[model samples]
Target: MNDRDVMPAFDMLMEELDAIVTHLNQQGAQLMQAKEYAQAREVIVKAEAVLAFQAKVKALQEEWVRLSVSSSKKTPRKKQPGQRVMTTMLKQGLRTPNEAFMLPILQALVQLGGSGRVIEVLDRVERMMKEQLNKYDYESLPSNPKELRWRNNAQWARLNLVQAGYLASDSPRGIWEISEAGRALVLEAKE
Candidate 1:
């Protein structure tokens, strides 16, 4: 039989086994009432076949479940590091932060004439983030906390983008600007 047939056979056999046992109990009682001891022994002997069938069906069902579970466990999943980080960050919704800050930060620096202090850039990014909030890209907080989690990720995004030559850092800690490379990136992305 095909696997589909085998799966249903497990449930069908158990049901049929139950009906057999019920019928056997009634037959055994009737034989006993008639004081037919030999016939009652025959009834018990008849039930042995059904009982054996039940044992075999039960074993088959157990084996199916065991194999199904083991096969599922054998398969493994792989994800990129940034994708993994984003997944973790999204799960921290209502508790932590966003993976949505990078692009907005880039756009914000460009809007500010391709340069701004870190705090000013962050402020512009936050406003843009709020405008996009209805998109449900992030979880809402009770209040805009002083320490926004996405803001922290934005800083990390800035450092990484800078290293990648997308942005340039000035000598002072908070000042930043989009590099010519960063301008090209923004232009390319717009297309």
Candidate 2:
């Protein structure tokens, strides 16, 4: 099966696993209410095991997405002068793609000493990419009217970076940190 098909299946499995864990927790709570301490402990243990398995599945899914993205990076295409001009004009009207945020984020974090608050990193990234951002990027998102489209796209890019092992998945909320792989990527680019 293709990546798209596999991803949805994995998502369904994760949802089912989450439901199982919730049910197990509820059963454990009921057992506790009945004063069946040993049964409650067993149920809790089962829930923990399911949670661990869920984590493993999530890791595998993230790895798959990372591999897919890495494999799908396209080589630059050759075009006639007219086509090139048209492409440039078209690009200016379109919002920046999420992949474009990866390096900027890593660079911003490195400049911040490998970690910083989300707002700080985003601000740095904005300054770095000021010339590249287009008017479309400045518009508000439909789902979140208070948030700009570019900021929402940047947050989604952050999620991709974390899944790809370039950002820390376990960093405290509101903080963004680069991983060793992320640092290596930036250094490699410099060379």
**TM-score winner:** 2
Score every model by TM-score.
0.42, 0.52
Model 1 TM-score on a 0 to 1 scale: 0.42
Give candidate 2 misplaced runs (Cα > 4 Å): 1-93
lDDT of 2 by residue, 114-157 (tens): 99999999999999999999888888765456898788878977
Scored by lDDT, the top model is 2
